[model samples]
Target chain A: MAALCGHGAPIALLSPAYNEAVTIVQSVRSLLSLQYPAFEVIVINDGSKDATLDTLIEAFELKPVSRAYDLAVPCNEIRGVYASPRLPRLVVIDKVNGGKADALNAGINISRAPVLCSMDADSLLEPDSLLRAVRPFVEDPERVIAVGGTVRLANGCRVRDGRVVEIGLGRHPLALFQTVEYLRAFLMARLAWSRMGALTIISGAFGLFRREAVVRAGGYTRGTVGEDMELVVKLHRQMRREKRDYRIAYVPEPVCWTEAPESWRVLGRQRSRWHRGSLETFFRHWAMFLNPRYGRVGLIGFLNIFIVDVLGPVIEVLGYILIPVLWLLGILSVEYLLAFLALSFTFGITISVCSLALEEIQLRRYPKARDLALLTLAAIFENFGYRQINNLWRIRGLWQYLRGSESWGVMTRKGFRAG
Target chain B: MTGGLLGGLWTASLLMAASSVLFMTGLVIARLISEAGRARRRARREALVADMMSAMDGEADAARLKSEVREPRLVARALLELSTLIRGRELAAVTAALTQAGAEPALLRLMRSRNGEDQIAACEALGLFPSDKAAAALKTRLKRRTSMRVRIAAARALLQMGETPDLNDLLAAFDIGEVHAPLELSAILDEIARRATEAYLERLKSSRDAPALRAMMVGVLGRLGRYEALPVLLGAASDPEPSVRAAALSALGALGHPDAEPIIAAALDDPVPEVRAEACDAAGRTALAALAPRLAERLDDDEWLVRFRAASALLRLGEAGRETLDAAAGRASPRAMRTAQMVLAEAAA
Candidate 1:
């Protein structure tokens, strides 16, 4: 099915970069190696403080090109457009620091393909990723408005020429925990949501969207931290309002590898930012909160967001506090308290392990029993401390949301370990 | 008091926790056992692929190949794996040897499976054995009311077998309707048109009532570089549906026929922004030098894409277009000046 799907539809891959000099070249190289018939890679350097533009120009022999772009979507002023004389498929845009959303908008403006794929500069797609990701669009072109693929951690993988040549579990405990968390998130949660036709979030790490649909939906809301989720929700809202038949799909076969944060501080900041972004999107689209007008997307999709994202954090934090307090105040017995905590932890482990088992059975990307065993261990151990820390970060994000904070905390990157 | 009210909750929590732990442990053990078995099977398959490759290269005899072919499914898997790495005579040798070993019956049986994955795999495997029987089975799959994926796979298999179904049959097999005009579907149409251009063109002519289908067919003709499609495309340039008109203009642009200059010139003033934009693009693609002035006039068009494409079209008109762009860049409307300057800078670079 995948081999028959990718015929000759030109697609544009948009990679929005901000201070990504370390990984941009590798990412572009991997994208250029994709096995699609026709595609162009447009790298938008969002006014990085580092020498990202310089590095790209040096690597690809880029020169300023006189290309006209439309203002179909609003973005910051583009500094210049660059293209490599040797590489016809590579286009570079230099624009002001308008955030990732703005950079993506800038990319959408310059790209001329019928379909547009938005990805991060820090992630590398498999060689056949585009061919696999594009199946839904080919299968049902009229209804499938957007599609997302699974993203896996590349922290401990052996990298050669921007490809994950060997898969291994991350050495850091935090990274290991995230590996299981991502497995659960993408394999269990997203797959189920996609089956229900209520997939509202196509990860910013890698997602494909119909160019016209995205352009009509106002191209990634600029000020939102969760621009990916916001764009999808906006699509659902507009399509539902206009009473259009559409689908947002998720395919698990196509895999994208991204570096996971290894440090506690970085992971915390990332989680909090993600939580804050979800909150901002949910609040902005509060009208669709269980509103039947939006169909399943409103009732099921948004309801999931409200339960898991909005209230789950508060309830979790309350459980952490009240379980102990109630026990200390004699309102709850010791046996009852231990049982309750054990149930929560065990349930968390069960979910994580289930996702791991699903991945092992289906993907087998790990290809090693030791890696699976380590992941299983991480899943069980995470319930002891990592999950609690994550909830605390979510609580922090909630606090920041209440205080009306809009800052996107700086996320540092450690470049992939080269072969 | 504590025993009565909290008793049920405690018991339920403990039971749930224990059950979850046991369930998780059971799943892990099951996966580990499954992985170990899979590993052994993978090793055996690797050895079989080695044997098949050796046999194909004539290092080994057909007796060894026949022994391995006892498991037709495994041999088919090996052939599929080696298909990507080997080609030309090596591929033909493998296919002939596998066909002689009777891998066809197993694959044909697999093709009749209810599972979509098995059907897809069977279709691909049958592509290697492009006999009349294989083609017949593939065509039968195409005619079935199965999933689109299976149908596409079957169609691709037919193409691999060097069989071009009638254009109507192919369209119906694809389940192409008025609303379903995916780009890849157009590509399949383009591929079919490539094999029998005139027949496909005549089929397209009868699709006038299906506007989307007509537009897609017209676009395929343009991509195929069918110079004979000029008159038909010219008629389509005035299609009632804006989408068809846009498609015709784009196809005309792709064809770059000199006779399309007049229509392309008039389309610059099209009421629809998309048509006008395609007109500007067509003007540039054909290098309609005579339409340089008309394309220049569109620099002040209301639509940004139209203005951009017009400026690009002027740039393609050699010296005349460059002078117009230079003039516009120096003194024109703010929108036009910005577009002109950007276009010229790109040209200079």
Candidate 2:
């Protein structure tokens, strides 16, 4: 927010990139152009095989610097930290290959600020996003560990000058479904949860975190598919255990537009990875389930997570198959099975539509009126195909987990074409 | 013999109906059996939840607790129980379980669902626990959402959280001084919930997001009676966006600002009916006597809401308004008469 310029706290942007020669410059540009005055850009070059390191150095006119490292964060090894020869506020880290998590860690290790931001290489942040995100940390010094900005589907949205000015629906149905899901997910689900004071994950693509809280929780867990969720959970565990006052917040207006999986292959991989991350996080924190000593947060919050989120696909898929099959076999009656299915579908659609209506009542972002109509249709159609396909991917993810497949596969990125 | 034959035909018809009934009953019975199975599965899930809840009184084993109640419904029930615990002032254990459970993407996905009661329940759970996960989800739920239940729960949670970014966002998003945030926010926090403070800070942080944020900043300044934001509010009053300007005026009026009189008076002539209504409210809020004549002009508006709004504004003018309204009422001009009567009653009350 322009109003937040010269105000709020200093924010350090961290982009841990590997082989992202195509989009690192754009990402860095967005950070440098932030509306807030106190922010400095930090880009971690995680041993990219391509000219990712050279590209950033050349573009920003990079120079090396000996930076002291006491940010209270536990992170991967860093090769060296650099600052811009032209723009001193811009910092770069040339780090060994540690993947996204490692690069973020290195950035965290080198950042010199109160609040830290993590951004994906291909993501675009609104100029005001940083101020909007970090304001929580400054206002409530005693509490407030992290804050998440809204993430929008960038596949169809027009991007220019490293910013997304106009938002649009995706061209392909896969991207479209994801777009709707992101809207419903962030706009509905995350908003509702944050209001409830039980936010678990601050997405890695765009979020601000307190350096100490994150470091105390052991920075980003290396080799993890979803360090975002893991870090949040770890933060919750530590903060609540110490009985310290803290919060992970959500900001509605500060948006980050990132590419979604536009094709089936990509969607499948993304969904599977997400599922794996969830499973891994669940497995690690399994002890907190309904345990009162951890108080309401542990027993209730984690318990709900286990039931409503963790094992949702397993029961859902089984239920879908069993009821229909049993009815066809003259075991369970067709009429009854249909009724059950209809009730589930009806309720699901009702909720989705209501969420759509909420969007209309509060933030109507899609430029066209028809977009709302289309989104509503998308909500209805989701139960038929999108939900099922995702369910399939989730179930497959579980199956893979059972087979001890821990490695995350390659994800396609068409990269943000100049919109 | 003819009567007997007729009775036999009726008997046959009754028999056919009885057979159809049997078939239908048979179908229903079979359905019941399957529902029982699903219910049994649910029961198993709930049993695990019950155990987790019971065991959670001591150590937090969210990972284990979730193993028992993996069904969203069961989890919803567990979360409901969890909400009660948090509501009861016991937050630590349940929050841990919530975090542990939320790690499951499906549960997170389901909990994030807009319309599901289970989603609402998860929101409630997060509210009780006051964890990062819950806070994040509830904040996201604030925008472009559907369910009032979800929204209310989210708002209540943030209200409980106090002065956080989410609170700030909510204040920014929903703070029209004339229109409050569902009235639930008023009752949600007695003490300054840390989360509320966080929300307040967040709003201040993102106050540049236009109408919502600008309007909220003015409203908060007006409601909290902050003189510091006066210039900002005045600037906002003449904003290019009518809604933003009106919001600023309305906030100014609420704060009883003398400076907004001309703007409020001018807004009475706005092209938009809503702007006119807001201007009328602003006039009442500001107690701008100069706008009384201008406000009377709206008593003839085609829109009944404007007439009422104008009447209300006029009512603040005391004897002057009573006289104008009486003239309209006496004349039995439909719009003015009805609005005049209601205003007279409201003013008298």
Candidate 3:
């Protein structure tokens, strides 16, 4: 039974490529190289005008077929969910230009499997990522509704034979900031919440959900900036109301790595979209806030999501806005203002550093002394400017959400390769 | 103005802004370094533990397993898991590793745990692994050992062919509470309890365990259809604990002791509603129609829970409970009370 680690499951990967010509091949190759006994890769050319579809066809010998099945989520119109007979498992959904949500919905409806995982098209998975990702479901039935594997900063990490070989430091400052932020968020924030069984988001980049639960929750909502958060919240609402025992989960293993935005413009757009989606989810289920009928999920769970999480960035922005005024108005003396900022900065740095310590305590990542020193510096420096910039972007996101604006922007990738 | 009081003030203000700028630069630098190092070690740690399980037999091997391993808890777990895998004495190293890891206060607490699986493994690991290696480290827990799991394990180990001296250390670990506790170390505690079972029963004859023990007597005697222990059962009808009194009432009914009817009648007004409620259930169950009127009178009890229970009890008492229940549900009880309304509806239904 133990030897059959990668056996049993017939798997498929759906890479919804929108202007992912640079990453399409690498993503497909990673999926094809999975250690599973049998599996296929499906690259959905989500109406990218670029060489995304052509590159796949030329490289993997793709041929089009009629849309196979229809378990798609409701975001955009599906022109056709296509398939290639040569590599039948390597089907391509040639759909009309719908956003990511529609592309995923198309993939879901077309695919036939009890288990389906959704990942960002640019991201690359480890050889047995799917096998490890699906372990919990096989081991414990009914208790687990979704399983999320770990994602690391792909910025400086060396990709060798489609696997991360040596962990390298990146030269780009923006990419570096994202690495620390992702580490702190995943290692500290998500770990704690998942431990408490209040995991709200199963990251858009790398997360797996039980096919039936996703469909049962009416799939993903259309025209939402935060489709990930919205779909996860809807699942929580449906499960709690039906009084079902289920869990949205996270694993600590780094199963996938995607390109982080090296440019501030792309990073700002990502943060803005995340904030807008979070607000939409909370406001959509505002009724569950403090309602005891929902049990532990209602009061404790939703309250944490709403106040501590969704509204946190905005509150932080306000704190930033208030500090300057307080100093100018003499409500706060110069020394007092500096001290308060110092204390808050120190506190933020401490949490990151402690998270690094705890992660190391459980599973040490940076083996080299220089790597440890670099991570320590990153932990200390993360709280200052990057946090402020994030707050500003989140504020912008909140403003855009209130103004009813939606931006389905595309992110450029610097393809995964050997260091 | 040259580096004096006013100059100090100006320099301090300048430094504040500089600190903010420096802070921003620090954050950028940190991000740079963090991105440089992202590590992944797939499932290799579990395999390491599986290896340690059997290599733990020797003190040197145990020390090496303990010292060399990163996460002793996981290693110990892997050791146990490996022990399950192969049909051999391979887990010596694993238990040795666990005992070394278990020297920590938290793990020691786990070793002497009241919990089922966790404690058993910890106990077995501590005992099976060379005890001499962890003896000095465990010496501190001598007094606490008397608390539960240790005493049981100690008594069991003492019964084995031959073991080293340290009776005082073992005795200090034996002082424990008398209650039937559901502890993480319950089995170990119970095993220890077995060592003093004769003395415990002697103590029980004049102790608080007398009530729970007496209730057991009621169960035994009632099943035999004998009226013996009636005095004890009647005395327990007034016991402080409602659960004890309820047990007595149940026993009296099973025995068909007519002498308990008066005490059962008075107990219907017992302040602790459950006792009164259970007494009513036993009375009604035993064909005590004579007590039906008194039970029916409780239909309008102040505590709505009691009133609901009485209505439920009366419902089982047949048509004889109608007149009393009907009056309780009459216009005297306002529609504002939903409990009464529910009771009336349930009785009608």
Candidate 4:
């Protein structure tokens, strides 16, 4: 078990907060309760207009501390460093609003830990998340530079004292649909990719990385909305090019419960931004697409992402519109149209159901049968309307990306339901 | 003709859709049944665990305990739980109970199962039994070209069994060709260093081992900080491979032997920047004041990391090193100045 401690690599959990005053306190509290033996929680207040820094300062009893930190990575100016006298492991950095990547860079510079765990301010990690997620690093200390945990929707879960007290299905249709989607993405796709040693993205919600490797990969690249994916790709390229044995792993057990956008508007914005980020990363690392030099990552992982993820929406959206148009124009026979529709919908439902089955076999987090039934229903119902809307949003994202739109869009959060 | 073609396509797609629907329905039913079964098994296991706990309190006989947990899965689970909860004589007692229950044979059979996941579970279960047979089974699995997951599980099982696996087999299994060996080797060596330092030392001295593996071994030795490894590390400092040489230099630093200062200082002039960079770090660790001047010369080196290391090493040398950095900051190259400033700022913080 001592070896499981990653050679006793100290971890720094960095939460870059931006106007998340409502959720920041709970997230920080959740991070503070992590079961890891050696870790420090550093919250970077990215010049939020809201009282995020004030909330953290008041909650943690933080006092300004003069500390010397290496500027290991380039970042925007950090205004001040604060530490809690009561909790020595808790540190907060007040810095200008330099987006997520810049804030992460600042956190990297301020952190002294050998390992860094980047987290979203609105996400609540399970108590043993760090302990479980760090196993890959411990097991493969030389080659495993990064490990990502599964991110589950917290919309339906009951929260108390910054912890998920009760797990349940949200009555919101959008929330339930997103839960199934998250489960499918994390449990099936990410797991299969990681098993093949071609995991491309460790969700920004919760990911652990070696500080040295991240630093050597030039930290998180600034200005990209997909900084997390960009960083993973950069690490893969750098490590592979240097002929170093490395693994970017995804652990399915350690769950990071994150607040999902309940409203269609917010969800649309989030999906569009995510799609744009994927496209940006895809184009940025175009050299790796089908390039055998990068091995499985370039040959399979990159192509899978490019086709199934990046271009999937465009194809689906076009299918939806073009089929109707073609049928109306007499080019597509009504019988053929009906059959095609049936095939697509049923196949989609089957994949979703299969993902649910995989979830049951592996994690089985949702205890109540009623919740599982609701999720199954949601998986089926999502194909009717929710998925189509999501496809359209992603298509819109593609349009925006082509139009050179770099806007992250305003993400309004209602915070988690506390009990 | 077109009508017939369309009809055929329609019929085909309809069949595909219907089959998918049927497949999903079957999966749903299967999942429900499996979940129900698992729940039933879990309830039984819980009852058995409670009985075993009471038995541990002297309420039940060994024969009764074995009968109470007749199922192989239950026995393995109980043993795993008890192993972690109790230690010393209590653990020995639990192991004895498990053996009497024939847990070893059951687990050995499971370890040889065709299913990879089953093999992993069995390997983990075997870890609860501290027997030579269990260790041998795990070692055999490690040598097999099993999935990476199963191999790692077997290796961990062996570690739990307190067996030091052959380092060469471990390296070969990981395929240390062009890339560095998997980091799991580090964990294995960490465990080995604790249990069998002699065996680890012998492997380190074996020239047939991969350079990356030998270098990693040197790192493990350095982390162990065994003064006895100083001679081996000193010999490794001049290895043909620069990576091994760098590893040796870094290990020497970790060992913190001031007597190795000459060897480390010579590495500062090595053709490889990586080796020289490690030498600078080693100099800092050993507080080689004589090398401080030479380290200062690296402050202007072409390699940025080497320059950074040189500056940091100078900082570690205290007042004399501080003088060298101050001089570099004022009169040396731009990179030297930048490095010195950053280190000084860090030092102040």
TM-score of each: 0.87, 0.55, 0.56, 0.84
Which segments of candidate 3 are over 4 A away from where they belong? Answer: A1-11, A66-68, A71-77, A81-88, B1-349
Classified by CAPRI criteria, candidate 1 counts as acceptable
Q: By DockQ, who's the top model here?
A: 1
| Preferred candidate (lDDT higher): 1 or 2 | 1
CAPRI accuracy category, model 2 = incorrect
Question: In terms of lDDT, which candidate is stronger, 1 or 3?
Answer: 1
Q: Estimate, for each residue in A1-419, the C-alpha lDDT of model 3 and write its tens digit.
A: 01111123344465678987876777777777777655566666788988888888788776554432433356456664444555556777777777777777777766655567788887778777886776555433335677777777777788876677776656577776676677778888887777887777878777777765787787778678788877877888889888877777788784687778888888898888888888888888898888987666677778987786577987887877888898788796666556556656766666666566555556555554455456656766667687789888888888888898878566656665585
Sorted by DockQ, highest first, which candidate order results? 1, 4, 3, 2
The model with the greatest lDDT is 1
Which of the two, 1 or 4, has more lDDT? 1
Candidate 1 segments exceeding 4 Å error: A1-6, A138-145, A211-216, A240-245, A290-295, A333-350, B1-60, B85-90, B113-118, B145-147, B174-188, B208-218, B228-246, B258-275, B287-294, B318-332
True contacts recovered per prediction: 0.29, 0.00, 0.00, 0.15
Q: Which candidate is the best by TM-score?
A: 1
Candidate 4 residue lDDT tens string, A1-419: 11222344578999999988877877787788888779999999999999999988898898887664657688999999998779989999999899999999999988866679998888889998887888776555556789999999988789998899998778899899999899889988899899999999999999999887898889999888889999999999999999987889898999999888888899999998988888889999999999999999999989998897687987887888898799788897677677667667766776777788788767778876667778877877998888889888988888888998888899888877878
Q: Sort every candidate by TM-score, greatest first.
A: 1, 4, 3, 2
What interface RMSD does each of the candidate structures achieve?
Answer: 5.8, 24.6, 19.4, 5.7
Task: State the TM-score for model 1.
Answer: 0.87
DockQ-best of 1 and 3: 1
